[model samples]
Target: MDPLSEVLSLLKLRSYVSGGFDAAGDWAIRFGPHEGIKFHAVVAGSCWLSVEGELPVQVNAGECFLLSRGLPFSIASDLSLDPIHVSQVLPPNPSGRILSYNGGGDYLSIGGHFTLAEGQADLLLQVLPPLLHVRDQLGSATLRWCVERMRQELAEGQPGDFIVAQQLATIVLVQALRFYLSGRKAENPGWLFALADKRLCAAMAAMHATPGERWTLQTLARVAGMSRTAFAVTFKGTVGLSPIAYLTHWRMMQAADHLVSSRCSLAEIGSAVGYDSEKSFGAAFKRVMRCSPREYGRRQGGKGGPMLRSGPTSSSTHTGG
Candidate 1:
């Protein structure tokens, strides 16, 4: 359970400042992400969520949508877009009302931090479609429960407001995952389908849980209950990446993240990823990330090394503390 515990712990540390906005006041509310996933809920009435580089995704009262991956996005109201720093529309459409705010109840939003965790949690989270919107008709019951839970947290906001919000976010996430898992059939290709097979899911969990394990084609093959040759071909075809590549990529990604967020030394990082020597680890890191561990750490600190000078001082995927 330690694996599941790690995933839950990171999520527990996350919260999307729980609050509501009312349209009766004709007020304009805005915020900037300066580092995690944000979950916005439309509690009552409708408001416009205008994200740059994409059209405004409308939300009726009671609907919930995550800003996908928390990229630099914006939400605004009608008759007033000011005080809100909106990204300028390229090619200047200045013509369409991206989103329409209607009369009704209050507008509610929940913002929370999100990150990659270990094993099942990490792999499951990776399959999510960017910018998930749960319609009332398609995902109503579970969505309603999530909305009510968040609403309660926002209203009571007691001694455990943070903890309660974290729980609600998880519920919402699980609900979304449930919907995503059942929504499509064999007709549509999806990342989550990889988890549909019990064998694949179990094998994946083992590889992720112990990247440093002396895992090989045969080991993973046995886990999947398939012959080495068959598993190798199927794994690649279904996952779009060879099993070895997938393991290496996930290990390096974890190593890179640790380099940025943890004080673990290079030797520790190498050991964590199954490398016996710092040279081997550094070589793998460079081969994959195009930079050494130190330089990668610098980029993760929010200052770019060479290519990405203008964005993310902390190499973070989300904004804010």
Candidate 2:
């Protein structure tokens, strides 16, 4: 798998809550600080989305936005209006339904949140902006189709609708990320943006494809078709980390995943990630993750299961409607 796919696969999404609300006349709803990424697409009409500590953004029909940091936010027909808490408008326990306010009609939106496995959210969050907004021109028709289908699944309440809606919501999140990557100019120094540079991406892909390979600056530079000095300077400038630093980080991440989800022995896990000894692996894990492998696994309950599961509220964001 590619680097992006590898990272996402390791995240282990647990649950998500998919739903939306409709309102007519002047109205605003305040959602409290959230734990995971929240996404919403304007199915009809428009509103102002005000995230705490940021300027209010106007979202029009056929547009969508993602809230990455789990900040408190408000959606309103007019920002001047007093916002009602979302709990007041939505049932105490949301059931993935289309909620209505003031009899419904004028404004409509559909979306949800994705919750990742314990202690794994930062892998994606560290590389994301606070908010991502995707306009119609930048978004694909497939995203629009997913939004419409999600709306139908939530509103109609057909058998198996929940499963279908959840899958579609996941698709929306992926597509939004794709558009963001495609439209980005690589002006920023981040692993996500580094993919925009073909040379950097080729080197990154090699590391991701074989974290167990003992990679050196020269080997990676050769993979990128550049001299060692040039590759080191460029990689640090663009990816914000030396090539070996990134390799070690990626190896620890892979080790952590295995530690949490497998019954592998410490030596086995260490050897798989290119560490010949448990001592080296433990030191590296502590350095990158701020904890030892055993401790991290204990914190996560050390259960083995499939990487991705269906559920509610987590982290990440997207842009578009």
Candidate 3:
């Protein structure tokens, strides 16, 4: 699998709620702080979206935005209007329905909230900005189609509509990330942004494809068709980590995934990720994950059995509406 696909798979997206709302003139809704990622597409008309800690954004027809940080936000036809909490307008349970407000019909939008596995979301979220706004001019055709399809699926409520909406929401999430990568420059120092550089992509792909391979700067540079010095400079500049550091981080991430998903012994997992000794693996895992492998597995309630009382784990939970 490619690096993006591999990382997403390891993150393990759990559930999603797909729904929308229609509103008329002079209205606003304040959505409280949420968990996971939230995405919205303006289907018709427009509104002002104000996410805490960020400037208010004007979302016009056919435009989409993603909230990666799960912050409090509000949407309004007019920002000055006194906004009501979302619970007052939408149902408590996400039923994939298009709700109406103030008699409806002036503005329309559809959205989806993705709830990823606790403790794994930061793998993706850390590389993303808090708010990603995809304009109509920023190659949003596929995203537009996905949003429209999701709107229809929610509105029509046909058989299998739930599954269809869920799939489309996933597609929207991926496409949004793709568009963000394509439209921006590689100035940002994150692995997600590094994919925009062809050379960095080659080296990263090699690391992801066979993480167990004992790789060095020279070998990875050769894979990227660059000298070792140039490769190191470029990799650090774009990915914000040295080549070996990134490799170790990726290995630990793979090991973490295995710890929760597989019944492999610690030695086997360590060897699979290029560590010859379980002690070395444990140390590396602790350095990167802030917890030992065994502790992590227990905290995650994986095959490692019941949770033992320990210091706080790095995992997080997102409860989306």
Candidate 4:
């Protein structure tokens, strides 16, 4: 798999469109900052999206905005309007219906959150721009199609709608990432930069393709067609972690997957992820995932699967480069 696909697979993003809003004249809703990403798409009429530090951006019909870093922001008919909290505007009505917001003019939009379903979200999505604005429906047919599908599914539920909606949401997120990266000038250096490097891409592909392989520093450097020292320094500089560190993260991720998905013993899962013994694998998994393997598996299997604990709310924003 390609580097982007590889990373996304590890992330296991699960998304859903919820709480549709139909507003009219003088309306605004403030979304509090939280972990994960949020997206809004205008179906009819226009609205303004304003985050802290960035100028208010007008999103017309057929346009969409993605806040990748969960920065606090507000959407309104006008920037000067005092915003109502999203919770108040769209109360906890579990009926899954399009909510009507009547003030004066006619407007309609849909918004939702994209959550990392598994793996390490902070590390996997760290390279993404904080804010992504994609305009022009005609140019982005795939994105438009995904949004429309989601809208249709949300408005008129059917059998298997939940799974289909999730698949479409994934497509929307992937398209957003592609659209954001397409216009990137490569001014920032990180995984995006490293993915574009031919040698580094080769090395990453090898590591991802076969995490169970007995890979040494020398072996990985040879795969990248570089000397040991040069590859070590270059990999660390480009990826922000040593090659072995990255490998350990990947291995732990794989082990976590096995623990939740299969009934394999600890020893079996460890060996599958290149660990020689369960003790070594448990040590590394705890260091990376912040919990022991058994506890992680129990949490995953029990009621209410793992969720990122909410942190302090803030409006500080980071714009897309």
Give all TM-scores, in the order shown.
0.66, 0.89, 0.91, 0.78
- The candidate scoring highest on TM-score is 3
lDDT of 2 by residue, 1-321 (tens): 777777778887643546778899999889888887898988899999999898898998877888889999999999899999987877777677888888999999996888875676887877777788877774478888988888898888899888888888788888888788887665557788767678888999998887878788999999999999999999999878898888888888888888777767776777778776667777888999999877777766635442322223222121100
Over 4 Å off, model 2: 185-188, 302-321
Span of 10 residues, lowest total lDDT, candidate 2: 312-321
Global lDDT scores for all candidate models: 0.59, 0.80, 0.81, 0.75
Considering TM-score, where higher is better, how would the candidates rank from best to worst? 3, 2, 4, 1
Q: How close to the true structure is residue 205 of candidate 2, measured as C-alpha lDDT?
A: 92
- Per-residue CA lDDT of model 1 for 190-243, tens digit only, reads 335556666666666777687777778898999889899988887776666777
Candidate 2 lands at a TM-score of 0.89
The sequence of per-residue lDDT tens digits that candidate 3 reaches over residues 246-294 is 9988888888777777767777777778776777778889999999998
Report the candidate with higher lDDT, 1 versus 2.
2
Clashes of each: 13, 17, 0, 1
lDDT of 4 by residue, 34-120 (tens): 778888877778899898767889998777888877789999998888999988866565655578878534887767778875556
**Residue ranges of candidate 4 with Cα displaced over 4 Å:** 33-35, 52-55, 91-94, 103-106, 137-139, 155-163, 185-193, 221-234, 290-321
At residue 132, what lDDT does model 3 achieve? 92
Best by lDDT: 3
Candidate 2 vs 3: which has more lDDT: 3
Better of 2 and 3 by TM-score: 3
